[model samples]
Target: MMVRLGSSASRYVIATMAALALAACGGGGSSTPTPTPTPTPTPTSSTPVFTSPTTWSVDSGSSGVFYIATATGPAGKTLSFTITGGDDQSFFTVTSSGGLSFKSPPDFGNPQDANKDNVYVVQLTVTDGTTPVNQTVYVTVIKPDADVRVRRVGTGFNQPVYVYPVTDGSGRVYVVERTGRIKILDPKASNPAATTTLLDVSAEISTDGERGLLGFTLSPNFATDRTFYVFLTNASGAIEIRKYKTLASNNDQADTSTADVIMQIPHPRNAHYGGWIGFGADNYLYITTGDGGSPSDSDGNAQNKSSLLGKVLRIDPATDSFPNDANKDYAIPTGNPYATSGGAPEVIAYGFRNPKRASFEFATGLLIGDQGENSWEEADLLLPSDYGTAGTAPNFGWPILEGTHSFVGGDTTGLIPPILEYAHGTGGQQGSAIIGGYVYRGAVTSLQLNYYFGDAATGNVWSVPTQSIARGSTIKAENFRLRNGGFTPDVGTINNVVSFGQDNAANLYIVDADGDIFIVEKKPTA
Candidate 1:
């Protein structure tokens, strides 16, 4: 190869040639700009990359697993995940693979330091080999007792059939036993320490099938008048509606001598002694009785106008105007459905085979649970003539049209169809017999304002939108399936739910024939 040399001078040219020849062989010049160096692209690690964090909550004593997105890259780089900034670090943890989970369940019942409810917060950091993205997460710890339970408020009640909490500021829940004794329960006590017999007519009433002291209620003027009412059957199977005065000295005791016999009607035969009574929103006394003590009503008592047997009788016990009042103790309200010529002035609605229970909501006339003979158990909604009036009308179709269909070959000419009816069966059966329940104006948010009634035989409780009925909507009372409002497991077992009653606070209580009282509260899981 020919050498090209740069000469400092002609004499130095020769030496330069030799140096240039050496440089060509791999020696470099100290001042020459060897072909401007090509610029390499930045390594791609400087840009920030990662997804935003999200928030979450979980019940205390429960495990929770959360997810995160796969991180982006800083060129050929992989991402790393981490967690930071959390209190009570023992309760939660995060894995390097972006999984957030509870290390241990948080106990809201026994909070670590504060009596107040707790919320756990933690930050998740996701890095893409270059920059990190931080997100905030919140986990809530819920109370252990927050989930409503069929809390036994009173136990060993000896056939507690009814629970009536008087609005007298006493916080006493009166439990009526089938053997005819009214027991008292303290609001502050769970199992009754000892049943204080508020009233003992145990020796007076018949406790045969569906007989005995069935149900009772406190007078609207109970606080001042100290009066309460009870429905019972005498030894002769005669239904008696009576009022007794509470002892001034003790809220749990009543004056036996103060018994004011409101009505005493002979219940013939002895099977369906329609045994339930309560004051309506109108403050008027409404009584429900069977079409006599027979199952078939072959005696035609349910359709007879003169008979109070199969009728819903409305009377103002204060006015004492009942046409058949033995003591002139109760006055008939101005507008009785059959006050003119149907059968009796005391008959508000006609044709009930064996109405186990009936209740009146000021907004929606009346809901009568008519126990069917064979096929249909009905919940009849009687609408008032003057939709203007609160609870007014409806002629229930008794033996003739048992639940929208013919039972004893009776015509439906004037029979009001049942708003709801369910056939008899065990699984989802409305139950063999229908026991009327109250419209829930209870404290449970999920079950609030819904009408809850159960079967005396099946313990199956069902609800219908009372508001829907109030609007007079076409929502017929067909046996609607039981709904726990998305709350878990069936409402425990009511064990022959004899009745449903509410405390002064509108907290609903279940009266089980098994001698226990259950209060329904808000379910935490809801």
Candidate 2:
């Protein structure tokens, strides 16, 4: 359609024509041109993730490849792995190939983790060119299923009470029989059944109840002196300590004419004869005695500093202190607790109740198995400072306190409690009699430096960390059979374990009341 222009339209057309004429002729004012803008590149998205599990189980005492880190990242993007944080990160070391391992082998018994638990935690980081990922890893250290078993070394004795290895470089062991016979047998022989009688005093000693040829030990100078000692009950029912000499011509026979009574204590009752004798590293004779054999120690023998019936008596058997008394031959050690004044000159420490078994641990300290009356059985430890003039002799709570529990009526003041104790019953934590064992310094790595003890009534063996005990930690005993259940097929339950013995190499043996001896061994892993 055609339209007519108004007056304002006519003016706009004239101005547009005049501006076009000036630009064509290059007659406009100074002008500026607009610059072009830079374009933004497209961003590439990346997601880094760990394909491995966050939880892992690492075998104790194993060193390599506990975990292998597997991860995924964006295609053609470089990926890296690193350990970033956590309490146990110092224990772990990672490889560029994603293999993770411990800096050293982890021990289950004494964990090196920050929390002292077997569980270890660590933070892991994986990074790509575009994205970074972090993961918290939890590694649980598991104990090795060690295979431990006992191999029978000998049998056919009359209630063998102890097996003492001969220190004369003979490789023979002296087996003590409760029927008043001490037999020498070669455990490594092709026929271990052949035993030679070293001493037989069945006619001179009484063997009625808890009495017999109970304890024996070779002198530390036996190789040169050819001397040994024995503990037994005399015809009058008193505990007798005697000394004898071996024949110069025969190592297996004791010279009957050389037998002499060293000392005798009046033990009227028919039970609780302590009778455990051994030579300490100081070469002094150490003898253990019971509290004169009455329930709850009614005679008050253990607490009486003047009485020798319930004390650990240390003496120098080479010299005589009681020269006037023919029976009292031994001289008290110089550093004995009572050697100067308060109690019997031979008494080193007091307060013991039926410490039937005792041993020195790796030439360091004394370990005693004190049988409780009604409720508990305990293991007592005497450190280096607790004996021999250190003036720290601990009064092991006997009548006053039985295994950390206060008994009927006695002063509990200044009493040193037992380091380990168990209740009375047939369960895991209970046993009638506690047979204390030696601190294992043997070839078995799993049982290294552990104090092995057991119950005589149940024949269940247990162990505690000796290092922890030395550090003054009262730790719970671990059941040996339950903890190392991977025993060999031929191994079975040990019945009536009366005592434990050790050879010169520190190899441990279990002595059965039914006349069997077993050597504890650990089968090698394949």
Candidate 3:
């Protein structure tokens, strides 16, 4: 919501009609008794008339300080105004009547880089001691439309964190570009020419900043087993997931090669490796991992169900190796609530401090997004009958608790809370980190499909509807009457809203770390 600039004075009426036609051409052409022809006095252009209260709103609650007023020329004369763009203009307090109040600006830490749909042009000059008038404001800042739309398509991509898009049902999209390349766009090419580079892995991933080649999946029978899966971090930091087999003829992917590695996890800390992979609805293969980074959870590994880090794993991969005997490449779906207690049998939800993105609701398979820490940021729905047909055990409390409170005490009893929770401090408007998404079921959007997804480290985008959620017998969960809709995000710039895929035509895709790839449609309605 911080992409500001819309106080709307008829959209800045060309600097207020050229400052009222230069104040009616400097008024004065007298002739009293006889001394008449004394004209030629034209030099009075004093423009600086920005009246007060065009629009302003404030409500920070947990704190104080909010004064507004910023005057400059016109009414009386001697104009003066100077309160440029923002970044905390000393917290703001301009009153000579031009009013400009402020006191709540830092909590956006990185909220998707405060997206104004990628627009930045700020100017506010109004002086009249010697004439100077300029006005150009156009700040949009959006993020809450969710038919996803990270679109940048492709480029050289060096710090390209993660993209993961896969579509092959015809219009050809397949993105995946976390420096370990793979970019093919082909909207039926002839000259579609948007982005291309099937797969590279920069000689085996590891591009840093939370490590690269983050996650991808495409093998629910990719038309005819073109097979795919990736979740990298390799080059020594560890976390691998590997598996590929494309060959290229028309699927457009060209060469893939390696066919199996399935799992790794070492990660001595390059950054929270909550990689994020999907294939839920029982086809088995759901991963999320992160308590391995720094900050609070230090080494308790987010509740240590025998260290899979923060945990959410459920792999089966259909075999290539690494199954039984504890852990190697994958297997462990025997319902996994810690399968047999010795621990790492592929966990299946345990505490979690960085469950980046987990979605599945292609018509009520439930299992929604997760991301909570610091002050709060969560969203969950689960319920495939509570994961019994296979994919069981779900605790999700983390470091004793966070969205319901109790940061480090123990026994949150049955755990599992959060149907929605936001607030990261700084007078609390919300958002620090939590970018989980998807619950649109797109065909073009009528909207209420029980929406429940999130995003914000400043990337904005929010929705929380599954009827507003209630579920309470102590397992914790409550979110009522909520309605924060702003920033309409569906234009561009989306780094790390990571996983939201769906193809075979239910249509929905929003993967981004930098290797952009949007496509969430539904704004038509003429």
Report how far residue 208 has shifted in candidate 2, in Å.
Answer: 1.5
* lDDT per residue as tens, model 3, 1-526: 0111123212111111221233444435665454456789856435664443332222211122122233455555666555665433444444333333333332222222224232223344557666766553332223344442323333334444344445644556556656677666643343423666666777877777767786777777766877778788888878888777777475556455555667787877887777777787578777788887767685788787778888777778876345463326666666666566656777766777776666665423334455665767665555433445332466677778876778876887667676667655321124567666655555655344545343545443444454334433121112211122222233445534555554445455555555445555555544
Candidate topping TM-score:
2
Question: How well does model 2 score by local distance difference test?
Answer: 0.75
| Candidate 2: stretches off by over 4 Å | 1-148, 387-393, 470-473, 477-493, 522-526
Each model's TM-score, in the order given? 0.66, 0.70, 0.30
Please give, for residues 211-269, the per-residue lDDT of candidate 1 as tens digits: 88987988888778888888898898888888889888875689998888787887786
What value does the lDDT take at residue 440 in candidate 3?
54
Of the two candidates 2 and 3, the one with more favorable lDDT, higher being better, is 2
Local error of candidate 2 at 237, Å?
1.7
Q: Supply every candidate's count of residue pairs whose N, Cα or C atoms clash at under 3 angstroms.
A: 15, 0, 29
Candidate 3 C-alpha error for residue 119, in Å: 22
In model 1, what lDDT does residue 34 have? 64
Ranking by lDDT: 2, 1, 3
Deviation in Å, model 3, residue 334 alpha carbon: 20
